[model samples]
Every structure is written in structure tokens, then in C-alpha cells.
Target: MSARMQVRLWLWQRISAALLAPLVLIHLGTIIYAVHAGLSAAAILGRLHGNLWFGGFYALFVLACAVHAPIGVAKMAEEWLGWRGARVTSLAAVFALLLLAGGLRAVYGVVLS
Candidate 1:
């Protein structure tokens, strides 16, 4: 990647990290509270389903994950797998697709089911 691209990716990763922090905390806190309260799957699903705010939050969370993971993986591959340039870019693209697919699937299960 060029210097400009690297800077952009770094900025994006930082932004995504900032977005993820609160979402992750909220998710973890909800899970812990729900488990402590003995909330059933159906009860949790009830809160998630038909809730636009929750849906939007999960969507944003998924998008951030999609952006964050590939960039991190690209750096990992460069260090560990000796990948760079086009190869790293292609791998990151595949990683992004997989992240999007899995993340959105989770969001759908949470929000739609």
C-alpha cells in the first residue's frame, strides 16, 4: 500500500475501534446481566427482534468489524505470512467478505429471529 492508503487504513481502523468499544461493552454487559437475571433465549430475542435501535446498533457493529478485521489481518499476513501489495489486498478482500457474511448473519439472528 502507498503511504496515503496506509494512513487512510490506519485512520479507518482507529475510527472503527472507537465505534466498537461501546458496542462491545454494551453487548457484554447485556449478556452478563441477562445471564445473571436468568433471561431465556426467547426473552432476549424478544428484546432484539422488532427493535430498530438495536438493529441499527448491531448493523453498525458488524460494519465496523468488517472494516477492522481485514486491515488487522492484512498486517498479520504481512508479518507472519509474508504477504504484501496485491496479495495482501486480495486476502483482505476475502477476509472482509467473510467478516461481513458472518457478522451480518449474527445480526440477522439477533434482530430478525
Candidate 2:
């Protein structure tokens, strides 16, 4: 990638990580509360289904993950695997797509089911 593109990617990764930190905390907290309450799948689904706030939260979370993970992976490939150039970009694109599709699928299953 070009120097400018690399800088943009780095900035985006940082921004996405900042966004994800709180969302992940909230997610984990919700899981802990659900487990503590012994909430059934149906009960959890009841809370999520048709809730716009939950849907939005999860959608943003998924988007952040899609953006964040690929950048990290690309960096790792460059640093650890000694891979670079078009190959890394191609892999990152595929990884981002997979994350987006799977995460959105999960959001749909839980929030829109």
C-alpha cells in the first residue's frame, strides 16, 4: 500500500478499536448478566428481537470488527509472516468480507429472528 493509505488504515484501526472497546465490555457484561440470571435462549432472544437499540449496537459492533480485524491481520502478516503487497491486501479483503457476512448473519439471527 501507499504511505498515505497505510496511515489511513492505521488511523481507522485505532478509531475502530476505540469504538469496539466499550461495545465489547457491554457485550461481555450482558453475557455475564444473562448467565447469572440463567436466562434461556428464548429469554435472551426476547430481549434482542425487535429491539432497535440492540440491533444498532450489534450492527456497529460487527462493522467495527470487520474494519478492525482485517487491518490487524494484514499488519500481522507483514510483521510475522513476512508477507506484503497485493497478497496481504487480497487476504485482508477476504477476511473482512467473511467477518462482515458472519457477524451480520449472527445479528440477524439474534436481533431480527
Candidate 3:
């Protein structure tokens, strides 16, 4: 990758991490609250359905994860596996797309179904 591109990726990774920190805490807290309240999956979905704010929050969470994970994976591949160049970058991009698709699908199901 070009130096500028690498810098951009680094910036994005940090930005996504910043977004994720509080998101993850909120997500975990929600999970704990759900379990403590003995809420079933259906019950949770019932509350989430048609709730735009909840859906938007989770969508942002998914987006941050999509951006965050592949950058780390690409870096790991470079460091640990000694991989580089377009192929590694392409694979990382593919992984990010998959995360986005799957995560957003789940969010859609919960929020719209």
C-alpha cells in the first residue's frame, strides 16, 4: 500500500476503535440487563422492532466493527503471516464486507422483522 493509504487506514482503525469502546460497553451492559431480566430473544426483538434509534445504534456498532476488524486482521496478516500486497488487502476488504452484510442483516431482522 502507499504510505498515504496506510496512514488513512491507520486513522480509520483508530477512529473505529474509539467508536467501539463505548459501543461494546453498552452492548455488554444490555446483554447483562436482558439476562438479569430473564428476557427471551423474542421479547427483546419485540422491543427492538420498528425502533429506529435502537436500530441506528446497532448499525453504527456494526459499521465500526466492519471497519475495525479487517484493519487489525490485515495488520496481523502482515506481521504474523508475512503477507502483503493487494491480495491481503483484498481479502481484508472482503472480510469487512462480510461482516457488514451479516451484521446489518441481523440488525435488520431484529429491527424490522
Candidate 4:
């Protein structure tokens, strides 16, 4: 990757990490609350259905994760696996897309179904 592109990726990864911290906390808190309340999966889904706020929050969380994870994976591939060049970047991009697709699909199911 070009120097400028690498810099941009670094910046994006940091920004995504900042976004994810609070998001993860909130997600975990919600799970704890649900479990403590003895809420079943169906009950939780019923409450979440058609809730745009919940949907939007989770979508952002998914997006942040997609952005954050690939950079780390790419870096790991470079450092640990001795990989580099466009192929590593392409694989990272593919992983990001998969994360985005799967995460959004799950969010859609919970929010719309």
C-alpha cells in the first residue's frame, strides 16, 4: 500500500476503535440487562422489531467493526504471516465486506423480522 493509504487506514482504525468502545459497552450492558430480566430471545426480538433507533445503533456498531477488524487482520497478516501487497489488502477488504453483510443481515432480521 501507498504511504498515504496506510496513514488513512491507521486513522480510520483508530476512529473506529473509539466508536466501538462505547458501543461494545452498551451492547454488553443491554445483554446483561436482558439476561437479568429473564427476557427470552423472542421477547427481546419482539421489543426490537420495528425499532429504528436500535436498528441504527447496531448498524453503526457493525460498520465500525467492519472497519476496525480488517485493518488489524491486515496488519497481522503483514507482521505475523509475512504477507503484503495488494492481495493482503484485497483479502482484508473481502473480510470487511463479509462482516458488513452478515452483521447487517442480522440487524435486519432483528429489526424488521
TM-score list, all predictions: 0.91, 0.94, 0.94, 0.96
In model 4, residue pairs whose N, Cα or C atoms come closer than 3 Å (at least 3 residues apart or on different chains), thus clashing, are none
Please provide, for model 2 over 16-96, each residue's C-alpha lDDT reduced to its tens digit, 9 standing for 90 to 100: 999999999999999999999999988999989989899999999999999999999999999999998999999999999
Error of 2 at 40 (Å): 1.5
- Go through the candidates in order and give the C-alpha RMSD of each one to the true structure: 1.3, 1.1, 1.0, 0.8
Poorly placed runs, candidate 2 (over 4 Å) = none
The per-model lDDT (C-alpha) reads: 0.91, 0.95, 0.96, 0.97
**Residue 21 displacement in candidate 2 (angstroms):** 0.7
Residue pairs of candidate 2 with colliding backbone atoms: none
Q: Tens digit of lDDT per residue, candidate 4, span 7-31?
A: 9999999999999999999999999
| lDDT against true structure, model 1 | 0.91
Per-model clash counts, in order, read 0, 0, 0, 0
For this target, which candidate reaches the highest lDDT against the unseen true structure? 4
Residue 48 of model 1, lDDT score: 83
**Candidate 1 structure quality by residue, lDDT tens digits, 4-72:** 999999999999999999999998998999999999999988878888788888889899999998999
